[model samples]
Target: MKLSEGVEAAIHCATLLAQLEEGRTMPASALAEYHGLSPSYLLKHLKTLTAARILESVSGPHGGYRLARSADAITLLDVVLAIEGPQPAFRCAEIRQRGPGALEPEVYAAPCNINAAMLRAEQAYRAELRKTRLSDVISDYLGEADPRALAFSCAFVARNQRPQG
Candidate 1:
């Protein structure tokens, strides 16, 4: 299933926000700059995340976005759903029922095997995402990232993050 680029941006932004100190926030522009994404495009996903309570939007000068709850409390699934909506990636059109030599509706009472299989796969995919918390992602990244890259991230966060009053 093809997902939107927004999903990657939102998750990465959320993970980056996890690096912020409590009571601090990172602006959408900063997040876009870090990932080389368009602020306008990233802001749309950020707004959706805020609406989903995965992230909070603070207003005024020195205002920006922060996780609404702890990173451990937010799963990748939450961010994904917030950006992509709760709809399954594969929508079953039941094309099998519309082709020539199609049987009566009663004959197809049971779901199409292909649709059921795809749905099952999607369920497994979502379950895996649900198992992954933002904290886990950040921790894993920190453990394996190159030193220079880590230092750069730390420096950027220090420079761009704002303190909330």
Candidate 2:
């Protein structure tokens, strides 16, 4: 199942926010710049993340966003649902009930096997996402990313994050 581009943006921005110390935040513009995304485009997803309580919005000159909770507490599934909504990726249209060979509604009263299988797959997908936390993501990135790339990212965050009152 395909997910929206916003999901990637949200997760990346959230991971950046996780790098901040307590009471610090990064502006949406900085986040957008870091990812080479349009500020408005990234802001839209950031707002959705705010609404989901995965991130908190702080307004004013020194305001931007911070994680609503610690990085370890926010799962990849949380960012995904905040951007993609809670709907299952595969929706069953029940096409099995239509066509010349279609049986009576009563005959098809049992749930379709295809639909059930899709639902099971979706459950497994979501479970995997739920197992991943932002902290885990950061740890993996830090462990595997090139030293120069990691240094650049750390410097950018250092320059952009603002401390809150």
Candidate 3:
């Protein structure tokens, strides 16, 4: 199951927002620039997050966007759903109902093994993702990097961030 690029972008953008001080805002352009993404596209992703209430936008000279809740409170699934909607990745077209050798009405009522297997896989994927929060991802990333390097990266993002007009 392939997820959209917006899913990745939204997750990264939310993770970065989680790093900022509470009440601090970061512009969409800043987020896009930091990740080398297109600002227009990133803004579209940001709107999804906002619509999900995972992030909130503030308007004004110094206003931009900030996480609506704590990082630990947001799950990977939350970010994913925000950008990609709540639709399941695997869609069953019920191929068994069609084709030359279609089953009879009584037999066709039963669930196919393929559908069951896909359902199981999707459940497992969601379970794993639900186990991981945005906080966990950030902690894991920071744990592997040097303090100086981490600081430098943060500083670079801060320096390069363009405040919204």
Task: Encode model 2's per-residue lDDT on 45-164: one tens digit a residue.
Answer: 999999999999999999999999999999999999989999899889989989999988998899999999999999999999999999999999999999999899889989999988
lDDT score, candidate 2, position 18: 88
C-alpha lDDT (0 to 100) for residue 83 of candidate 1: 87
Q: Rank the candidates by TM-score, best first.
A: 2, 1, 3
- TM-scores for the candidates: 0.96, 0.97, 0.90
lDDT by residue (111-132, candidate 1, tens digit) is 7899889999999999999999
Candidate 1: list runs displaced more than 4 Å.
none
> Which residue pairs in candidate 3 have backbone atoms (N, alpha carbon, C) closer than 3 angstroms, thus clashing?
none
Alpha-carbon error at 79 in model 1, in Å? 0.8
In angstroms, give how far residue 128 of model 3 lies from its true place: 1.2
lDDT of each: 0.92, 0.92, 0.84
Ordered by lDDT, highest first, the candidates read: 2, 1, 3
